[model samples]
Target: MKRTVITVDGNGMLSIPSNLQDLWMSEGELVDMLHVTAMKLHAVIRSIYKDGLLTVSEVQQKQETSNGIWQTLY
Candidate 1:
């Protein structure tokens, strides 16, 4: 986990730092995020905009790759 301090914009927008931005991308923009308090390390999380499990396109671009070792070469 990484952390950095950023300024909230006049209208209250939070900009993620450059490096962390690469990890969490959304809607062609980095998501506007908030942290909720939880007892456990991993909390039951939800996206700010969507109601439930996110759509592939809405969350990020989708690409498919196969593990080369999975094939039967014989």
Candidate 2:
């Protein structure tokens, strides 16, 4: 996992790092990527709360399932 520190603006908006922003733009639009990322995070949080400490494989499986469901919906 790659990590970077970012600052939120006075209005609570976040500034995407330039490299990450470029990646998102390549895939689609930044807003759409952010929305999908938020949804994935929500799913991960729920899974963690329900199941407790997960292994890497377990987390990846959960993420794949969650992504599949979201893709089906949207």
Candidate 3:
């Protein structure tokens, strides 16, 4: 796997590259994600606060993982 650095706009938004957008099934889908980082062969993630902003935070009880795997690669 390879990693690419993408720039976020002043509003912290990124423009998905056309080719990459097509590569991902979740491209246009609504997804709840905490954080994302791609380095070398890894794509790391974790639960995000309901609202993905710096100041606002989600409580601990609300951070537990739910049953089963919502996403996994074969």
The numbered model that scores best in lDDT is: 2
Task: Please provide, for model 3 over 1-74, each residue's C-alpha lDDT reduced to its tens digit, 9 standing for 90 to 100.
Answer: 22222345667687555555222222112132224333311322232332353222221112112574343221
Ranking by lDDT: 2, 1, 3
Per-model lDDT: 0.37, 0.42, 0.30
Worst 10 residues of 2 by lDDT: 21-30
Cα error, residue 26 of model 2, in Å, equals 26
- Model 2 stretches with alpha carbons more than 4 Å out: 1-3, 21-74
Ranking by TM-score: 2, 1, 3
Off by over 4 Å in 3: 1-5, 21-74
Cα lDDT for residue 1, candidate 3 = 25
lDDT digits (tens) for residues 7-36 of candidate 2: 456676977676642221211132354556
Cα-based RMSD of candidate 1: 12.3
Cα-based lDDT at residue 8, candidate 2: 54
lDDT of 1 at 36: 30
TM-score of each: 0.23, 0.24, 0.21
Q: Write the per-residue lDDT of candidate 1 for residues 1-74, one digit (tens) a residue.
A: 23233545777887657775435432212222333333221223334225556543554433222553321110
Report how far off residue 42 is in candidate 2 (Å).
Answer: 9.7
